[model samples]
Target: MVKGKATLALELPLPEEGTANTKQERAYQAIREAILNGLLQAEDRLPSTRALAQRWGVARGTLESVYERLQLEGYILRQVGSGSRVSAVMPDSYLKAVIDFGVTSTPIGEVPTSNPTESVRSETVHRAQVGMPFVARLANPQLMSPAEWAAHLQRAMARMTPDQMCNAEPQGALALRQQIARYLRNHRGIACQAEHLLITNGIRHAIDLVARVVLQPGDHVVVEDPGYPAVHRIFAEAGASLVYAPIDEQGLDLSSVPEAVHCRLAYVTPAHQSPLGVIMSATRRLELLDWAQRQGGWIIEDDYDSEFNYHRAPLPALKAIDSVQRVVYCGSFNQALFSNLRLGYLMAPPQLHNQILALWHTVGRSVGVSEQLGLAAYMHGPAFLRHLRRARQEYLTLRDIVLDTLQKHAAGRYRISGEHAGFHLILWLTADQDQDLLIEAAAEVGIRLQPLRGYCQQNQLEPAFVLGFAALTRAQAKTASLKLAYLLQA
Candidate 1:
């Protein structure tokens, strides 16, 4: 009854032989209502439990107990030679919204309206319109103090014992890798120890475990021409081949990276060069560490938001002069202490620390040992440098109230670069304005901005946006920089 070529042709109906339902529960409710109405999608491929028990005429052990209850209820994904499919990630990707509450015993697909409280208030107003400011200008968990982070998670769960509440360390919690290896050897000089750190759940899980332990499918990575589009979809989902490479005024343009494209990896941020905030210059960080030592390549160095430097002093870290460990050094406290404190760290380069801790033990501990012993007791105390000197003097007075309200109302119609450090800045427009109608009139007053050609892939710089004043509030940063300087002077 089953062969190889008919993957899916679902037309399930059954239940009529004197019914209380069972042609294997009406073919497991018509294959879970054809995978919750999308008619079987996410990764698709289904049909061969003996060709769906000869197209539902039944008994191949009742379609193998209806695919062993849709693969034990996560709704399909079997494997062992790659057979049953449908579960690329769908335990419940919404679709069950059928309200009609007139209750005819409320059964046939049981109506339970108020769609999960209007789908959690439309996903909390789309996460408060993408955490506003210049859109995700993060770090404002109402400037810390939830009873000082629940008294440092109540002294890291009152000094958890009994084998630290049943062991966990996948390469984390060696007292938070000895306080992130003594805060990267006294602030980013990066001599490194604590077995060359690992702990991640940020910098996109350390570039998805260094693009699955150093990419291979067509290799060549480079990236950073108006970068960080989720590290170009995590190195094009690890099948690699990206290249881009162009951000100047001294950051990533290492002779436009194409000397016969052998580049195994490069993803830089050289301290402050995402969304165009240039810094990488120490002679383009020794010409990108001599093009990663003449192409033996590998250099992630995200250093995300280099501790909010309002103006000066904060360079060093290209894994602090890597003398050939060819840097992997990423860092994050979820953008310093509050973007749900997801925590982050990477260091690596001890010849790829056991292949990045064996692909971080197959992606298990994305971070948890009680939020890594409450961020190693708030980075071994002084309450994380007194909440990074009161959130760097309130994000350096909201980056001088968004640079004196966009230089007193968008003077000479926009051009400001990286504002000396992080928590967002790069305005740049004036090519006869209209960067998407000034980002849809700063999203009709609620403000979000974003577009620098949506972090480009083929250098088309200028005509910019990326604003973020780190969760604004100096009267919402002078009324969102005078409503984005009256939409860049209309």
Candidate 2:
């Protein structure tokens, strides 16, 4: 008889009393067959040993052996509190079975780990939408060459001594930090030592850490209206009372912020604000800094996608001018290099450095050592600069093509902004057109139009679409624009 805990919700097939193999083998084969047939899906939790044993009319000890074997063979994942789940990356036979079923799977949205195989089937289908092009989706093909990257990885691994591997610092490898320091000083004009810098998984992780270190429950945090939606969620999860600040042509409008609420932190994407591509003016940047200094608050300068400015020389980061160290600068390679490389850095004020470090150790430690070192090598090498130059030029051509197409085809129907920098631009739909209906029309014509309203928290802003042209070639953009123009005209 099965013993100990009560039964779980997981259902499992039972074997007959007089089976050829032992009850244990019968259960194993049944579960294995279920997985191979795609009936037992990946990440599916299994019935507890006690429950399964009771169902099989076998000893709980017998069921334990079966589960141990399956776990050893990489059939399922076993964790302390979470129970067992089917492994996401299955064996070749399981993958073959999935392929035979005529199904396809795409791993969604930069979670982490080895890319799940094309044959690997997930319960949820993540169909590709139109907004993917405008976003920093993936790394360039030329930059991700296996041969070249392997060489860099080899060099990075060789550079790591045995002692360097252990006692891994929560901040990051000093060597890599030094390289990042030099790169930032030369490229972004934000001067900082290795001590002020802390490597994070990405911008989101950095924001989470900052929230943990600086924010308390119900503390006010200022976020841009119609901003990156993810930022709103991050601060909210940290127990912040969010106050929305609207954006103008000069970037985040400080005038819009309510004076009654004392904000402890202000998050800004000054270099290139997402959805609205306005560069914050020098005067506005100074004003923002002054407010932070006066309020005794911190500014998270998200310098994402600042590298691909086309119209003029990129403006210096707010951190560059922050003599008072009120700015906590954040940058990520996900936009510059690839989305999968979730490597980003946080530059904190010296006063908050130790607190941030403490919070990181508790919540955000265990950054991939190889990735840090590999990125360090790539940054130090000539390829980094060479790739940037090529990407900048290519994006410029694509941007011009998009601008010309919109002006020629959809003119008078929409207002465009964000042409100054970044891979995307905003097209505000005029005449109070229904954004949902227009987006559906674009999709029908094989054009993916990202709705601007989706980014807004308060829904007080005008309806717009953020069009991304960087990923599309001249021909692709031209074709897509033709379809979009036709719909807009009607």
Candidate 3:
């Protein structure tokens, strides 16, 4: 493996003069200090053993021994080809014990995950039970045959060598990346090698990494107005100045992108616009590509909810038409497998491979090795395609039940949109009321509807609410839609 530089400069501490400890002991102390002081963060890859050993003037065997000790103690993770990374799940008490005392005999326990995205699953469940919008069961194992999944997992585990289990590549498991690349090429018309892909925690994580690597503070970027709110928050956190581009029936309005502001990046959900559910026109996709090529900017094509199109064949991803390597494709398994899975991948230009790998290492690697291996096995098997097919049909049925019930009960009262694809549809209210009040009233009756205005960062949109159907049963949809219709009319 190549010894790569980290985005964040990490200085290894040198031993003190006349220190009684041996070279190995001093090296261990320095590394431990780096982790405790936050110089080496969770999932940050350490320099190659050869490079570090040579730099510190220590024998390779000595470095190996130190690495082994750290691995055994749960301070770092080591794999054969992937080198070592600071343990992301290291226990907090271990750090406290180490810091308080000169030495800690007891190893730290596993650190709890702090990913906010993972918390969404809990919210999804609570909302789903109340028949709320944007709610989906998180990878309910029941959806797949338990015996089949267990068999696949066992096979995946058996195929793994000890090294493969210990340390996972920052990019992702090679087998999984290969399968993802193949799947994309076959299904989405995106042609790319496995190396061009990097597995992320989710779309947010992928977007954040791309924003950080491709954008500078105050750089102008285009975003879909009344789109996925999370996109706005992610870009803002990266210090990018967002220019809202409105969307119509055809998706992101290219004309709205200000000519004066030189856009460095554009985040778009082309397959099905996040809340609006409009496919971007082919002409628009080409025009966006032309804009990127001209400005030397990048387009992040978020293929959100692309798999569940109920109409004709899904449109080719923007990346499929991107000849200049200006489009970075972001996709996730959350919608496919389960929301709680938190597995997403990015396909980028070859020139960005090294930089993205570095950024991912620094940002914090997610998707554990076991999960990656198991997912790879699942994808490789027949079950993945089968599940998607079944899910599409099931969602379609649920969507119809909700829409049919709403139209029958609330006919001519509100305008409905977003029936072409995805798990939810929008209802534009004829009688405008405070969105919060509507939400509160609905919640009082045990329903949760997401207001469309909440998705907009700057653009003014009509009052509407999104009703998610994928998580609702036929009975739930029928009852909730009738109740919702009556509530709106009342």
Candidate 4:
């Protein structure tokens, strides 16, 4: 008899009477199960509490309890005059954003945390959540519930030996590089032999290694404005002068890039651009390649979300399009796979493999043999692809759930940006309202979010957030969404 039940269900025969005292509880359970199972669509109206009670033969008071629980769970919406509706959000994206928060180099004490699990989750704790996740860009692999990835890691580790860790982890650990290579081939269209690949800590380290070999102080590099801050920051730290290009729907506006930042480097997220979530069109991809070749600038193609592309099979990474050795295409399993393992590689100019290996030797020092070995074993083994496929499916489910639920409950008031692909979603802030108040209210409701303000370049800009989904369970995602929708009303 919960008031939040969806109106468009198949109308199964009502449950038998007397099994539960409070028919409202029974109603809530049924409706919640229906929503979780995707039996209802977004914007689907719900029967009033009275109507639901009549259907279940429960008193309206009992029905009220059911509605309260649904609201708490973020599975339903309630209004003074409006009826309750479904909650929406991208759970998998939120999970990844939580994990990535840890990958970047941040001041240690700056991250707030009392709970170890959350401490492990945010790169910085007390990190806010909401429509502003792009600004936060916090992705936490550690936050991924171990219970979920255990079976996959277990299968991969079953084959490992103690001696493996004792030995020096190779250029690309036989198992992991191979596993990674295979995935890149199948998913992102990265073509390379396992031997040619050099596994490193994460994409940042990989980028750093490349920076070491290819970039020198005063080097001019073109980057996207409002692009991945990590990329620009790293290059800037390495003494590279950057020409920041404004990004439009077509991707990075090369014209906006000053001629001065025209050294051999440019970083681009082609599948879905970071923060803004714009995919690079084919024409723009070729134009970028042409620009790189003509200017002799090295194009660092970041294959961040090509794996989870919702629009179509992912575009072949920009490296695949290179006839010249201009594309230093880099990607990592960190985003697609869980963290706790630093497994990512770069597909470089064929001649630069040895130089890249040499650079890793001097710069990063070493990566874990154990993680590399385990991930490799998974990659080579049948289960590796299976795990990816499973995650891929679940990520889509999480994305759809978030998008559908938000559209259902909030409608035109709150708008969602980004694509159906990727582990995270970006919600644009149309107004500069009291974002802090909104976030605080969300916490009061027991749902959490990271605001986009943290990801902003400076105070002069508006706010946004990079909500992740890889860690959150479907149930958790649904509950989080309902709480978020209520907050949106404020």
> How well does candidate 1 score on lDDT at residue 436?
76
How does candidate 1 fare on TM-score? 0.35
Per-residue lDDT value at 153 in model 4: 62
lDDT of 2: 0.71
lDDT of 4 by residue, 1-490 (tens): 3334355532634455553334644575577546544565345567777876666666878778777665543456688777877653223322232334322221111111122122111233233232232222233343344664566467656766777646665486777667666676665545667776777777888788778777766666677756666666678677766665666766776765544334567888876787667766544665676566556557787876566766545655667546455678787777666653566788787656789887777665566665666566556656556655676777677677777777778766566677556767877555845667776776677655666544434223455556775456677667676667666765
Cα error, residue 180 of model 4, in Å, equals 3.0
All candidates' lDDT scores? 0.71, 0.71, 0.72, 0.61
**Candidate 2 local lDDT, residue 59:** 94
The weakest ten consecutive residues by lDDT in model 2 span: 107-116
Pairs of residues clashing in candidate 2? 130-448
lDDT of 2 at 225: 70
Q: TM-scores across all candidates?
A: 0.35, 0.70, 0.71, 0.65
Clashes (candidate 4): 51
Could you tell which candidate, 1 or 3, scores higher by TM-score? Answer: 3
In angstroms, give how far residue 299 of model 2 lies from its true place.
0.8
Output the number of the lDDT-best candidate: 3
The per-candidate count of clashes, in order, stands at 1, 1, 1, 51
